[model samples]
Target chain A: MDQKTAGLNIAIFFCRQLDANQDKNRRAIEKELGLRIRFFPLPCSGRIELLHLLRAIEAGADVVYLVACPEGACRYREGNLRAKRRIMFAQKLIEEIGLEGARIEMVNKTAEMPADIGAIAMELLARDAKVSISPVRSNAVASFIEK
Target chain B: MITAERKPMAEIRAMLAPYRKILVVGCGSCVAECASGGEKEVGLLASALRMDAKIEGRTIEVREMTIDRQCVYEFIDQLTGIADRYEIILSLGCGAGVQAVAEVFPKMLVIPALNTTFIGETKEPGLWVENCRACGDCKLGYFAAVCPVTRCAKGLFNGPCGGSKNGVCEVDPDSPCAWQLIIERLENAGRSDLLEAIYPPADWSRQQGKGPKKIVREDQRSEG
Candidate 1:
């Protein structure tokens, strides 16, 4: 990890169906990359709401990532599609407020090996290096790395 | 229902530039159903505005309130005590609701955040089609339920004008010709004979020839 990826606060909202061992993989990625990553597992990606994405930003997440089952693989048919639409809508809302819509991203992955989760995290960190810190990061909360 | 769209962000930001404390009032009735002004929308707008203000290095206090109906006095009265605390009331309601808020609080500065569009029906989710013009006239009996006065480009009393082609309007290919809909509906009902009587031009006096219109329903009024 370079200077930009260091101390970056990443919030990942992923579907439970995407990974069975997320906690172990999350810790492995944090230890390897020196990045502060928080994982929130949901039953399905469709359970994600517009407010969920916004609140993540409000809570000082530099980049919010959503991981869902691949298109037709959603246990609840169309759940992944619904999550895609919501991500787009949320992106539009944040963009309207002069924030970078790319700050929020969605990845579709099947239940892969534990190493794949760490790879995804690395991919996200690489992407985050290109994006600037969130302007709306609240002053009240300390950086996840600092904590 | 009365349909409306949120004003562009640039226009809204301009309207709110002077105010530090703003109350975003949404109408839960017509505007809510149309998805323009509602509780959810109010929250989204408020959040966006706050973030926008923060990004600009400005401190702004934005509050949100959504009443059941903005056009009705009983519902709009709920804002009485809270409205005075804000520097401005940014209403996401339709035009009538905005004016009603201003009228209710004569001293407070009330501004609209939405552009009142038309009286429309939800054709489907996220799609609203204008269906009524409130022309102070009822002509449905003559032209099935499809309203030509509002839907037709020319507002022809007797139509399927030469411009109509392939059952669609010449002005907008996407919109089906209103006359074609009316004729088809009438024919299906075995009322094609009604077309024999040529109707005269519509009387405009009832719609806008007179100044603002009002109806005083003595029966509904409480005794003084």
Candidate 2:
């Protein structure tokens, strides 16, 4: 039985170095969508290791995403890129567990793009509301057994 | 340092098929540098295996442990207390380390989760190149600090053989001719005198020609 769409849970990890002001957009998105959002403020995207991504999933997150600064925009230089590689590795690990790799993602949007952050959360929540995805890029996705 | 690459997951799963409990051991030395086996790798592999077993509707327990160097007896002895809890030890160390664990825990089943590649150095991030053969001999002083046994395709003592062109090896275009590099280094060092001094055929005894090699260091030997 699929959980109610209203209760869709998503976890977001954002780099604090990108912007010190996500509270306004985060509150607005949560209020607008009526969805559960757990926002984690990290100092740098390099701190977002694969274990954190896996642990978030294991802790009952429907979808986990990292909003990293645009490439070459990371204050620490390549912190965003490092997070991208870690998320890709996490996706591979999750795929081995029969979970869709799409469940984990790292979007390159600057802190200036709070609208994009809210938009991404909205898009993923919409996707999670429907059904768990098959590996979206795989040939076997056609055979996904939807509940 | 000794370098190794992680074995494929399918093969690792097959090896653990019969065991309910496993200890995925990692070494903090060489394999770690090569990104094959280390603390991070141990946890990653353990998590992957657990997820695989769960997804397949099976039950398996895995534990992770990484020590300074798995090839040393004292380090292997550290696992003595907890070794028997698991049915198999999936070692992520080089070949010597895997064998070392087996020798220490004579009764337990041990297996290598990495293919020990060679003695080498990291050329760049995520890129490693083999640079030594460990012939139990050191001739680096004569060859301008480059090993023909490793860099040269033929391991020829006197080289620039019938195949080098544009400074690339005949067997592998990606590799620059080792002799060319040696000559350049010699010329730069003003050690052209060393060129006419042809090195005699290296004694094969230093190599792994006979059985297992040994060094009897009476200076460092402990009294029985």
Candidate 3:
């Protein structure tokens, strides 16, 4: 769900935090950016699979930034660690296919650094501005997933 | 699990250039786990080929089909009537699936979109690593379940070769010494006696080289 109507046509869903920390992270991004940021409150960063990241890109997400907790502070032990590896893998796949992999970004922020969230949002926005997506001109997405 | 990667778009598109009618087949078993030849991958490849080829006159009809297990006969039969509609079948399955499709539709041309790699497991999501050699004789019982024949660079059946150093293979530091693991396991199990059993030199003819092997259980067979 979104709180604001973004001036920019598109924005990405940045997944971060788990359980109780989830709502707080979402509200903070909505309050600070005033941009339509899709916040996916994941159980843990470890739960964010590679298929999720690839599908997000195909689904027209302008940018996907993972806001992870400090490396050691992850309550799920290796949640942030797993997310980092999946991003690296997805990045390599994109790069190999002649596409820029910068559409996905990862940032480490503590709960106390409220401004870091805003900074990351703005950074992603600036990056998105530099990159141009050749809009998918297909009405035949109906037969897209036949398999 | 199996490890596989997508064939380069250019190469894949080039291979299907002769055929105007294409059937993109996906195997949901091995290649699916590898994230290469699954339904999603088949779709992506079909789209890329359509976009890149820009073929005209003869319509490039891509009919996508994925079988639960392309290696099995019952699953391959699912393509019955659909097989005749396409000029060429592009398989996303392993070597076995391509053969199965060809066997089922002998008249049609079959092309593989994925290079079958090895029996592997997901070291992590999207990252698959080879772990089994499928040696006719099982040795995991002797090696703490880690198959040195597969994980080792040289496939050492005995203890670590001179190439092993600091518990790592000499061929690559990233690889753990499989023999070392075997020794540690053997020592822990107090079954060091099994180590001296010098495994007889493996017979290559009995395994994959035995030609297309088939197993039929006579007891399970029924005469109609």
Candidate 4:
């Protein structure tokens, strides 16, 4: 990871069904990328509300991503689709408020791809090279420096 | 149910820019059912405004509250004590609900977050269609329960207008011809005879020609 990616704070919310070994995967990804990552496992991605996504950004996560089960694969039938719509809605809201909609993202993962979480982290790190730190975080830091 | 949509985010942001402490009040009745003004929506909007303020390096205090119903005085009373804490009340209720809240807190600056659209029915998930005009005159019994005043592109009392094609309205292809639906329902009910009786011009006076309408029932009110 580059210096910029190393300092990035990422939060990933995923359906528990996507990965059976979430803790192990989270640890391996963090160790390899030298990045701070928070994993929120939900019973189903449908349980994610717009507030949860926005709160993540407000809580200093430079990037918040939801990993859902592939389409037609959700045991609940449409949970993944619900999560995708909520992500899109949240993205629009943030974008309207002058934040990058790309800050929030959704990825559909199949059970076969156990290492997908690590790959997602690596991809986010590479993406960080192209984007600046979240303005919400930078503004807070600026305010603190002023004080 | 009364339907409304959240105002454009830019308009809302502009209205809120002047206030530091804001109370975003939502209604749990019609607006909530329509997904524009509900407890969850209130939270989403408040969180968004707070984040926007943060990004601008401005401090804004936003609180969220949703009453069981905003148009009723009893439900609106819930904001009495806490509302005093905020400089402005941003209501996510319908027009009636916004006015009711403003009436209760006459001194407070209450603004609407949603633009009241119409009386509608939820056709499907996330789709609400206007189906009632509240003309104060009941004519559903004659029209097989399909209201032409609201459903038809033109409120034709004597309809068919000879403008429909393939059961679709000529005015709007997306909308099915209301008169056709009425005629089909009447025929199926063996009441095609009703079509022969011409309906006289509707009394426009009963529908807003007089001004804001009011209904009072003595039996429902407590005695003085």
Q: Which sections of candidate 2 miss by over 4 Å?
A: A1-10, A23-38, A57-63, A91-101, A110-119, A127-147, B196-198
| Candidate 1: share of reference interface contacts reproduced | 0.33
What digit string (tens of lDDT, one per residue) describes model 4 on residues B110-179?
9999999999999999999999989989799999999989989888878688899899999999999999
Residue range B1-224, candidate 3, lDDT tens digits: 76567777567767887888889999999888878888878766665454333322234678888889888889999998998888899999898888988999989899888888888888876577789867676778877898978888988777778988999989989988888888878888998887787876666564676577667899988897
Docking class of 1: acceptable
lDDT of 3 at B118: 85
User: How much TM-score does chain B earn in each model?
Assistant: 0.97, 0.94, 0.90, 0.97
Residue ranges of candidate 3 with Cα displaced over 4 Å: A1-11, A14-91, A94-97, A103-128, A133-147, B18-21, B43-61, B122-127, B139-146, B208-210, B222-224
lDDT of each: 0.84, 0.77, 0.68, 0.86
Q: Sorted by lDDT, highest first, which candidate order results?
A: 4, 1, 2, 3
Task: Write the number of the candidate with greater TM-score, choosing between 2 and 4.
Answer: 4
Cα lDDT tens digits, model 3, A114-146, are: 544445454555542533441221212312122
DockQ: which is higher, 3 or 4? 4
Question: What shift in Å separates residue B219 of candidate 3 from its native position after superposition?
Answer: 2.2
Question: How many residue pairs clash in all the candidates, one count each?
Answer: 0, 0, 0, 0
Instruction: Return the top candidate by DockQ.
Output: 4
What DockQ, between 0 and 1, does each candidate earn? 0.45, 0.21, 0.10, 0.79
Off by over 4 Å in 1: A1-4, A20-36, A110-119, A138-147
The first chain of model 4 has a TM-score of 0.81
